[model samples]
Target: MSSPKSGGAGWLVLLALLVLVLAVASVLVGASDVSMLALLGIGGAPADPMASQLLFASRVPRTVALILSGMAMAVAGMIMQMLARNRFVEPSTAGTVESASLGVLAVALFAPELPLFGKMVVSAGFALAGSLLFLAILRRIPQRSSLIVPLVGLVLGGVISAVTTFFAHRHDMLQSLHAWSTGDFSAVLRGRYELLWIGFGLTLLAWHTAHRFTVAGMGRDFSANLGLRHGRMVALGLLIVATVTAVVVVTSGMVPFLGLIVPNLVSLMLGDNVRRAVPWVGLLGAAFVLACDIAGRLLLHPYEVPIGTVVGIVGSALFLFLLLRTRARVG
Candidate 1:
């Protein structure tokens, strides 16, 4: 049998190859027919200027958004799970995404002239506040069953979502907010998706602080015993999670369980050592979302399904499986 380290390295390589394949396939599979041979110069340039334009402008940006958004949300989920000590907790469940959506709606209604960057900043700020609020609530709750934490988060998130919806309706921006909240890459283009690079940067920051997060995951007393500043680490982790969540939500909208499912799946296969698992989580997250997006594009041929819808269907099933598996272990 392969050693754990070797096995992880093997999976990393395999996942990297898979991501590359999917990325290329994503570029090729679109409304316009841009063949691999043409892209490779084997058959010269694309048949039409429109094909080249579409390839460079639409497909490439959309693919990059998928990769960045997937990896960021997955890493953000891992950070949240570590901090909450609950496998089911993630940005979507914990009110972060809903808060960001509210921020966007507020900006659209109150400050209609705000630029895209300004809107993103406002959304990220709200996300940070919402995440901090969730953490405070978690701190107040007495240690109980593991399931309680996520339940509370879900309730909190639902409340936030309702508030957002109410305001959106009042402002006559319900359809706009709904479109922004539903994850889809069909509208992605060169200028629109540049914000997601912030998520990429934050993901790298998360990796750098992986060991700190692992220490922080062991609860306050354990982190303190080792001379770690427990509060500071948790703050930093939440900042990373909030920033990534906001950026992804602002750019690509919500991709449901990209975070919740990816990190748990990575932990189930690889050990839960944050440092060891984070890179794999990122790679697998990107690949999984890319696969889902491709499936969404092809599922209805001319009419594409939203990536969020595809992920929601698959993620809900995986979440149920994880819940049952955890219950069995506890029993």
Candidate 2:
């Protein structure tokens, strides 16, 4: 039998291949018929020039956005889990996304001409504040049970979301707000999705600091005794989460439950060592979101279902399963 290390390596390789295949599918499975044969120059060249234009201008950018946002959200969730010391809490559950949306709405209402980058900065600030508020709430809770933390986060997120919805409704920007709230890649093009690359860079930074986060995930006293600054680590983790959540929200809309589901799944399989788990988390995240995107494209051919809808179905189901399983384990 193959050794465990070899088996793990094999799985990682398989996952990387899966992501590549899904990325290709994403690039090719759009409305325009851009054949692999044409791109490969298999048949001399694509007869239609529009195929090339559409591939570069639309499909490629969308696929890049998909992979970047997927990996970033997954990694962000993993970091948040470490800082929050709770498996279930993520940007979505902890009010980060709603806060980011609130920021975007503020920009829209007040500074209609603000650039996308400026909007992302404002969104990130709100997300950071929301995350800090969540941490503060966690500190006040008398009983910090495994499930209680995420319940608190969900309540906070819902309250923020409700506030956002009311304002959107009042301003007659309900349609725009809904669009920003839903994760849809249909509108992502070259220039539009460049911001997601920053999120990807932040994800990489998280990976680089994975050891510190792992240390911090232990109780604060333990981490302090070990010469690790738990507070600083947590602040960094939350900043990464806030920036990544904002970047994804501003660039591709909110992908509900992804940050909640993906990290938990990876943690179950790989354990909580951030350095060891980061790669698996990122790969699985990209694969999960990319597969969902492909399914959305094919499920109703020519008319794509939004990725948020698809991910919501899958992520929510998985989340419920986790909750039941956690309850069973605790019981």
Q: Estimate each model's TM-score.
A: 0.95, 0.95
Off by over 4 Å in 2: 1-7, 37-46
Cα lDDT tens digits for candidate 2, 1-331 = 3332333777788889999999999988976788967655666764677778899999999999999999999999888888888888889889889999999999999999999999999999999999999999999998789889888998999999999999999999999999999999999988999999898899889989899888888879999899998888888888899999999989989998888788787776766566877888888899999999999999999999999999999988988898899999999
lDDT of 2 at 225: 98
Best by lDDT: 2
List model 1 lDDT by residue over 183-210, tens digit each: 9899999999999998899899999989
- In order, the Cα lDDT scores of the candidates are 0.87, 0.88
Worst ten in a row by lDDT for model 2: 1-10
TM-score of 1: 0.95
